[model samples]
Target: MDAPALDLPFDAEAMLPGLRRWVECESPTFDAVAVGRMMEVAARDLALMGARIETVPGRMGYGPCVRASFPHPRAGAEPGVLVMGHLDTVHPTGTLPALPWRREGDRLYGPGVYDMKGGNWIAVEAIRQLQRAGVATKRPVTVLLTSDEEVGSPSTRDLIEAEAARHAVVLVPEPARPDGGVVTGRYAIARFNLRATGRPSHAGARLADGRSAIREMCRQVVAIEAMTTDAATYSVGVIRGGQWVNCVATHCDAESLSMAKRQADLDEAVERMLALRSATDGVSLEVQRGVTRPVWEPDGKVMALYETARGIARSIGFDITSQSSGGGSDGNFTGAMGIPTLDGLGVQGAGGHTLEEHLLVSSLVPRAKLMAGLLQVA
Candidate 1:
């Protein structure tokens, strides 16, 4: 027998107003008050969708998180679908006023529009459409909107993991790839503070007595850059050194990141960074580990989930493909726990975390329909 029909009634065009509002809010990750305000806006909307909204207190000096559960007619929260996203953005609070929201052709440009305020609205629109059709989802659906994802999701990681443990699959709408693909796996990332300490002396009068920390740091930077290969990377992003050119640098500090395609590769990269020795005779090198995100490799279960989602997408006039992303998301955390996850299921767009960020307006409805179909099916 043929499968029953599915009618996804979300008007993609009508989503502009709400999305525009979210973009205008400017909920930057670093601004506590602004991020909290944005969460309130989302909480009100989620409550209107018959969801039970919970305010999870923010940790480590960040804004609060919103947990909205839209229960199934029967199952409630018993092993359902988990939707993950963030209200926090990389742009500051004043970015919206200067950048503003505008559309050129099919691209909608604004702060946080593509990096994922648009994707977040896709979830809301999906729920609204289901309610309008009087369609009950197959299982409970939980939406997690955190306030600190752009700066590494430090506050929301534990909460996200705890919630994901109660669900079977995690759907991360982290803005679909501009090339029309979803994220199946992501690279692991490790950050570090590389500090070099050395004796300071006058550069001109006692050059031989001076042990330059900046020179040692430059040598370490060269070594780290040499370690960058196809499968792994080590790049120094920021550096600081002596105050004056006439004095030997007493201390030097640098921030670097290591990215790897696999756990073993990441481990190797970290080992290399930690083992780095000072080049100057009197300089000492120290590395302090900062934020680390595990690689989300495509395991059996995650790939299986993608297969089901691909079939649904094909039925809706779009043949979806799954690909690996170099950037990590919250999916990396859950995937580390061996939970099935599919990231980048959001609207298609380009230039995330940049001024040119935009969403392909044409993708709104079809992608929303695909998401609704996934939720309705399971």
Candidate 2:
């Protein structure tokens, strides 16, 4: 098996220090300065792989993006492969002190390790190994590490899509499924905010004159809940209204979200939600559609890409399987753009977006090898 499996040139244990360095950096999505620091460190590491690295200013008001271009050995015929990941984590600042980066037995625990920072290193290590082996990539490889993915990729969607459009394939090293599965399709997500407006009046003193926005929202909530069915699921996460028990609420707001397995389901669900109007005579409803991650539905070409990757894994003496994700990634944008994309190609880990997040130390070498092999051929 040692000979059959793609042997890593460098000891996998050596990779842990870099992982720790990244985790300790604490690059949360909301902190631009912190995320920028993380990107700066990543740019240096990516530059070591003989890539011409550049920092793209964050146009979406997030942190700057790090793009590393590895020139192909051969002149460009078709667009090369795009290796993409995000630098942002759901964890806020000061999380490292609380969770801390430490290795116990076979697990590395810290913020951002499992969700994505680990994935970033895996991709970087793959390229590092490739460069060390003197193997020139057949196609140019561009590694784009965006700073705002955990918060919905507001600044990087266009960048990811534009880059993927030119590439033959988009390789996203998002964290692997807890069971070591990769991802082929991801659900479309649309965040929504519904606000109800009404006139305020003293509840007890002028009960007949009051039209409660909270009551209007309550009626609309029934319709919102009903919108969840087999194909699409919807839920309201937050609700705020009313000043006191004696006063009718002039305003009510609800933060809701919907996820669909298909595009039609997403569109239909959004339309229905937006159609929700005032249930009370004097109340009015307003719907605002927030960040939307389009569905990454697997088509024939993408399936073929998956099959190719499955074969690559087989060559390395491992069985690779892919699953569909309810959550979305930058892969969604590329997949929606009809680019051949593969995701969850990063570290094998669980407990993403939690203080318990960890990456399997044993998975580092094998997953990195898989990425290297894919880069060599794809």
**TM-score of every candidate:** 0.91, 0.89
Error of 2 at 199 (Å): 4.3
Off by over 4 Å in 1: 1-6, 75-77, 200-212, 241-249
What tens digits encode model 1's per-residue C-alpha lDDT throughout 1-378? 012224666687799999988889889988888999999999998998888999998878899999998867655526988899998998987787666799999988999998889988997898888888777777788999999887678788899899999998889888887677899899999988999999999999999899999999999989889989987998998899999899999999999989998889999988888888887788999998878898888899989889988888888888888888887788889888898998998989888888888899999988888788877775
Candidate 1's TM-score: 0.91
Error of 1 at 69 (Å): 1.1
Give the local distance difference test score of model 1. 0.86
Worst 10 residues of 1 by lDDT: 1-10
Question: What lDDT does the true structure give each of the candidates?
Answer: 0.86, 0.85
**lDDT measured at residue 143 in model 1 versus the true structure, 0 to 100:** 95
lDDT of 2 by residue, 1-378 (tens): 123226658567889888888888888988899999999999988787678989998865689998898867653676899999998898999887878988889988999898888888988888888777677665789999998888678888888887788889889999887777789999999988899999989988998888899998988877788878999999887799987999899999998889999889999988987777776788889999988998888899888878877887887768788888988898889988898899999898788888889999888888888888778777
Residue 334, candidate 1: C-alpha displacement in angstroms? 1.4
Candidate RMSDs in order:
2.5, 3.0
Instruction: Itemize residue pairs with steric clashes in candidate 2.
Output: none
